[model samples]
Target chain A: MPDDSLSRMSLIEISGAIARREVSSMEVVRNNLEQLEEQGESLNCVARLFPEEALADAELADQELSSGNSRGPLHGVPLTHKDMFYRKGKISACGSKICEKYLPSVTATALLKLDQAGALDIGRLNMVEFAYGLTGHNEITGDVQNPLSLNHIPGGSSSGPAAAVGAFLSYGSLGSDTGGSIRFPASCCGLVGIKPTYGRVSRFGAMPLSFSLDHIGPLTRTVTDCALLTQIISGADTNDPTSLNHKKTDYLENIDSGINGIKIGIPATYFDEKVHPEVLREINKSRDVFRSLGANIVEIDLPDNFEVCNSMANIITASEGSSAHAKWLKEKPEDYGSQTRERLMSGLFFSSVDYLDALKLRNVILQEFLQDVFSKVDILHAPVVPIPVPTLAESDIQSNPGFIEYLMLLGHCTRPFDYLGLPAITVPAGQTDNGLPTGFQLVTPPLEEALLFQAARAYEKENSWFFPVLNDN
Target chain B: MSNQWSDFIERNIDVPEVKSALKSAKNHSDIKQNYICLVPFEAEPSGFSKVISTWKLKQEQTEDQNA
Candidate 1:
């Protein structure tokens, strides 16, 4: 295989090749490193690369695989993750000035799972500062540029993860989603990403932005790759039973069962209020693809929280996020980016009662959602972001005059599922008029991720992957 | 949002420390008051997991009945 073709293969495809000995893990790692060294700087998406460690591991993986040893499905596969997952003796800067020199003492449970599954961790990628901001603006590490176009923002906190996986630098990556971190970046970059049901994956040792809302999941080139990665990382983690106690299910068994007669709901309210015309056009096209796939797409009324869940999600994230950064915010406030500082400061002002009330209100919103929406449809389909890929100039919090509204606006569609702790996945809809791709979300009630994969698989089987054609610079 | 929360949220919003996130803080205060009345008296801050488990049980029971 040519170096570029090996780099372009999906996670599942590459792993299968490695299993068959058609390609060696070392060759794959070297191919990935070639791109990581060349295009990585231009895209501005890398936090740190571990070429030495990754190549050494890949050599060992090839040796072991030749001797008939395999760790798991991801064995000998190369991968990367957003900068926040803690790995002892490694600097997890988390795209912030506060932790620029911070060395973690423990490896995150999810990262450990990946290691045990025999995946090579080649690097940590750029992310929102402390995974707090939505758009990929991290002043500490320069802004993560969208791989498709330097002018557009790589929808973030999982910005680099999405960019790398979307650009095929790594077959897949693990990213945390508090609000839309994983899905938004996946949508903007035209990849498949899952923000698993909140408890589906263990969050122990990963950077905590919002303890309740944060979900550690994967972003990949296709639905099968996503299912494969999600299956490996998900299980009840004893160390994080408080947050990660959901039992794991075999995700791939019925993923190709197809969405025959599956009731996929198109929201009649709330979801379409601010969608871009071009994005809506693409969403309609996606609806057509689903219709052809034997899935029943029905217009269903989504339970309206009157933007109550929206504000409450903000409260919980800001409150918990601020609490996590309280000491640093007080003593080294200047270290944080302006937008990151401003957002954390807002968290301090919310009273204890207000925070408690937000938590209480969470269940109220969730129950209403279960009965009013999920009872009618196996999944709900909506646009990931209400607009096309934003230009960095437009989403720049320090420069954009509508920065506050922009922050809230972009997180609008994905925030509900984040706080509701439901399973939501983003699949590429199509490229908009501007040529930047966007995705539509398919959400299921908590713990119903298998259904989401089945539906997304049906759509993807009809639609080819929407990867960007990068010109050789 | 329930209508009975008019008397709530007497917290200080004019404080300069919050001026940076004034819009968000104020929005949270308003929304908190608007929605808190809807939370049943029996709800606890850590009860979210229980709520999901109960919801899942109910869903499974319904599916079993249908089957």
Candidate 2:
């Protein structure tokens, strides 16, 4: 196969080709690095590139493959990690200057797992500073331009991961989610991201913004790829106390199971209110597709504390983030990005009572949510973002105090799941009339990622939607 | 307010002393209700479990037969 063709193949396809010895790991890595060089400038996805080390690793992988010792699907696949994930000996700037030269002495469990699975780390990708913002703007490292449209925001926190995957610079990428960091960028970039159930994946060495809500998952071109990646990374880790003790199951096995007679709940009130018309239309289109696939679409109402749940997430995130960065704030406050510093500083203003109240309210809301929604529906469907990808100029963070409010609103349908610690998956439903991609979120009860992927796969396969053009690719 | 809560408040906010003052002064009873109940809701878990399990079993059986 041609180098370009090898670079363009999906994670599963690349693994198959490698297993058959049709391609060498070095060849695949070289192709992907070449693609990265050709497309990385326009996408602005990579924050750090280590081509020399990557080639050496690829050579080693090729030797292993020749010896009939393979590391399964991820072995020899070229992938990247979000800049925030700690990789020992690699500079993890977290897209900020405060830790510009800081290299961790330990590797994140997520990165270690992927490495053990035979994935070659190409480089670190850019992200919102400390994973705070959602607009993919970084004052220190420069904003990551969207591959689909240079003028648009590439959705943040996991911005580079999504942009890289969407641009075919990498087969798969790891992104951490507190709010919709992983899924939001994935949706904006027209990729698939799963914010697995809290504790489903370990966060041991990941830089923390909000410990209570952080989840690690993958961004890939297809839901099956997400499943494959998730299977390799997820499980109990002794390093992370919060990691679950659940048995690991084959995620790719039931991905194509039809959604026949599946009960999908649509929140009648909360999701329908104040949503952009274009977004609503796309969601309805997805619903129509699901209905045609024998899904039982049922209308349901959100919990009594739904709005409070949104507020609680904000409070907890801000407070916990401020506490986490206290030392850096005290010493190198000027080193941080203006927006990230401002947001983290704002968290420092919440009274301890307020923080505790937020936690108390979180418990109350989760209890109410479990009693209400999770018990009834197999999965809850909603728009990942109420609005399409807005231009970078429109969301001027300097003048607008409402920027965070608007961001929270865009994450309104998603934050509740974070607060409840439920598993959610976002997949491309279709595009708006103007051709911007929109995603439908499928949220399920805790640790039911298989069901969410099942429904997502069914919907994705049923409607073969067109992918957004990668400008100048 | 207690010392632990006071310490927690101090560490999180920018003006920790101000927050401590506010927490001490503000009445706990002044808590406002921000909850919005959509409707009376009930969940039938038994029915939901049965449906999901049956679906899984059918799927496995179909795969087995194909094999």
Candidate 3:
């Protein structure tokens, strides 16, 4: 591939080229690191670059490829992860002031697995402080800007990963989704992000926001890339007690099978309500595209208590988040960002009874979702963020009076999946009237990530809406 | 926010949004609905293992059918 085309290739494409010896791993890694250095500051995406370590690793990968020693599918592929994942003996600041100097003694299982597969990690990407905020604001580090329009906010806590992938700075990024971190940023940046079924991917070394809700997954430019990364990173690990024990298999095997008869559910309630006209228009067109591909779209009413149950997710998130940061909140609250501080402090007010009750209610809500919603549809299609992507100024919670309400509404569509521990994928459905990206989310029951990938791949194949060229207007 | 809650919150952290966020949590229909309800005294806190196991089995069965 040419130099210009090299930067835009997907992970699968790059991996295949490396396998066939078309491009040396050293060439791919050096080009990506150069691009990261060139465009990274403009996007506010990179937290730290691993130039020396990455170059050495890339040279080794090239030598191994030359010697007929391919490590795996991702041989020599250079990628970045949200800064929250720990790499032993290195600082994993987690985009927070309190942990600015905190270093972990052990690496994340996902990172180890990626290394084992011959993937080179060239840098750490930026994220919201403690992965707390939904918007891409980080008072400790600078905010991550949208790659499409630098003025707009990159929907976050996975903001850096999204921006890096959007600008082709890295092949993909590993991100943690507690509420909408992975899905939201993917939607905002027009990338493919999968928040796999909780526990499907072990959360061994990723920083936690909410114990019950945090999910580790990938943000890539294509559904096949998402599948490939998921295949590499998923499975049970004893280190994470909550990790699900399931048979490991190749996720890419049936990803291209298509969703000819897949029953896609369109929520008749909250998903469509209060949505921006352009977002709604794009989602409706996406639905038609699914129809054209021979899939069935069913108008289904989610459980009446769905929205109410969904609200409880915030309670769980707050209480658990506060607990995680309790020591810090007690000692050096002044060190934290105002939004993160306030949200975590609010958890201190909720009684133990409140947390336990929310947990029980979560069980009831999951049951209702599985029986009432999943029973009728193979997948649920909805907007990841209800409104059009907001600009940084518009989403500033401190200045905007309606910020909390806007935040809640933006999270409304994606929160329920997190609450139920289900698998959901966000794909760029279309652009808004202003040319900013908007995405439609496809959700399925737990452990049905294969189905989600199939549907997303079908959509991506028919409509090439992955990364729209940046309009610098 | 209630005086007791406000007093408790202010004792440790004195942010303005603390009171407001607590007030919103109190008023949030979902939180309030769950907070006011009563679970059975003998009902155990569900670990979600069953839900996950059932879903996993179904997924396996689906894959088997496809294969």
DockQ of each: 0.40, 0.08, 0.41
Clashing pairs in 2: A348-B12, A348-B13, A348-B14, A349-B13, A352-B9
Error of 1 at A58 (Å): 1.3
**Segments in model 3 whose C-alpha atoms lie over 4 Å from true places:** A399-402, A466-473, B1-15, B34-40, B58-67
Q: DockQ winner among the candidates?
A: 3
- Of 1 and 2, the candidate ahead on TM-score is 1
Q: Which 10-residue span in candidate 1 chain A carries the lowest summed lDDT? A: A464-473
**TM-score of chain A in every predicted structure:** 0.96, 0.96, 0.97
Error (Å) of candidate 3 at residue A126 is 0.4
CAPRI tier of model 1: acceptable
A145: Cα error in model 3, Å: 0.9
Candidate 1 Cα outliers beyond 4 Å, as residue runs: A399-402, A465-473, B1-18, B62-67
